[model samples]
Target: MNIPCPYCQHPITPGATTCPGCGTSLLREATPQSAEPTCGYHPRRLSLAICDRCGTFACAECLRLNSRQEVVCQRCHALEQDTPLPWDLREELGTFTAWWKTVVAVMFHPDTFPTFRPEGSAGESLLFAVLCAVPTSIVGGLSYMGFLSFVPYLLSSGNPSRDSVPSWLGPAMFVAIMILGPLLSAAYTVIQAGLDHLVLKMGGVTRGFQVTLRANAFSQAPWLLGAVPCIGPYVAPVWGLVARVFAYRGLHRTSWGVALAGCLVTPLLSCCLCGGIYLSLIRTLGGFN
Candidate 1:
């Protein structure tokens, strides 16, 4: 009579306590006799053993065992060996794209926004970068334009000099710009690196965000070319192009023609916004005058 061990689904002799092949305990009671072949591993007189991997049913004699001693049919074992692991490119892209969106959201609205540490320790770095960049950018720009110097000038005992621009204002603004400009740049670079890391993580890429951020930072070292005097204007466009390229690569996990479109559009949009603000401020000042 055919019998099968219940544990490992391997075949065993009738009335056996354990399976010789898989060490699974056999049924204590003997199964009813039948003309049809019963599973050698199951004493319940079942027709087949189910393959653990692919769920194929096979008689005890048909079962092929593996190193794990789990019963698997021949076809399943062969397919298991041949099949490759699953990869989801779209899931990867979603993850990175989500991360950058998070960074932008936090940057523009930190007071109301909350930080999420989906990529573990990276959340802290991202938060630090944002905290530094926003304030630095605003304050640094104002200082570069000499707005803050008016405070000390107003407090001075003597009346203002005849110079078109105030003497103290130029020196104060220069000091603020010199001190704050590089600091703002550094903060922006750091924030950008964090955002890049978040992008890589979102793309379902298992690589650490810190590693990706470091690599991107190194690749973008050319952004420092903005430090040059006559050459600085040209450097901004190049840096913008590089930023768009990196954004595309990190967000989509693949190259596409739209990346060039982003390069062209982003700078133009920023300029328009800045021009609008400048015009509004000029009108307000003129109304007061």
Candidate 2:
């Protein structure tokens, strides 16, 4: 979260007091007669940026980046100091270890989300989502490949070549599923997260999209259930929705109703549409028969 220099509109690093672009001091004093906006706390100092939390003008000396990477006034910053999630401490915890801790925490201890930092970079959130998605995709693909591998045995009934699935078909299907499963999962995660963010916005959430994205991604912790053989994929979707609702409520500081609606509405609509299409196709095929 880089701040733009008030003097030159050049991007400055967060917490930087001086602009490297123009070598200008961020804490310039306001002139007595000039008609420039002054800091809410110090009338003699020029305002550098408006506080994201309080919406008050603040001077460089009064402004600081909060735990969420938002530029806020000193008073607002002092009001909240959140602890970072394990995912945010990847360098210290090691990437895989941090991700595993975050998954467990999100899946079992979601109540702590309100106390953890709400903001993570968009890339970080997406990476978490992809990580969650990959395992489920791979497991589901493996299950399908296993079924395909057994198809010849079942269809052939002791005959190798007659009434059996093509020898190459199983491997072909395996290759296709292995390649497409993770890609589709990643796409679904992005699209569904975007839809959830829109619903959260409609529910009057003032937080940025990255916050919603982070919540949505972390909510997928339950997807780890895919490791369980037969029932994992079936159970993961319902559990994921439950986790999503909690994530939305805790991270966005919104009501349970808003969070539930945000997490459930898109999925429900999709189910209805698919169900309708399936019924129509069945009816058409029956008429042909």
Best by lDDT: 2
The per-candidate count of clashes, in order, stands at 10, 0
Candidates' TM-scores?
Answer: 0.31, 0.73
lDDT of model 1 at position 213:
43
Q: What lDDT does candidate 2 reach at residue 274?
A: 100
Residues 254-275 of candidate 1 have per-residue lDDT tens digits of 3434434433454566689999
Worst 10 residues of 1 by lDDT: 81-90
Tens digits of per-residue lDDT, candidate 2, 135-161, equal 766666676777877887886776767
- Local lDDT at 13 for model 2: 61
lDDT of candidate 1 at residue 115, scale 0 to 100:
17
Give the Å error, residue 126, model 2: 2.6
Question: Best candidate per TM-score, number?
Answer: 2
Tell me the spans in candidate 2 whose CA falls farther than 4 Å from its real position.
Answer: 1-50, 57-62, 67-70, 155-157, 162-172, 276-289
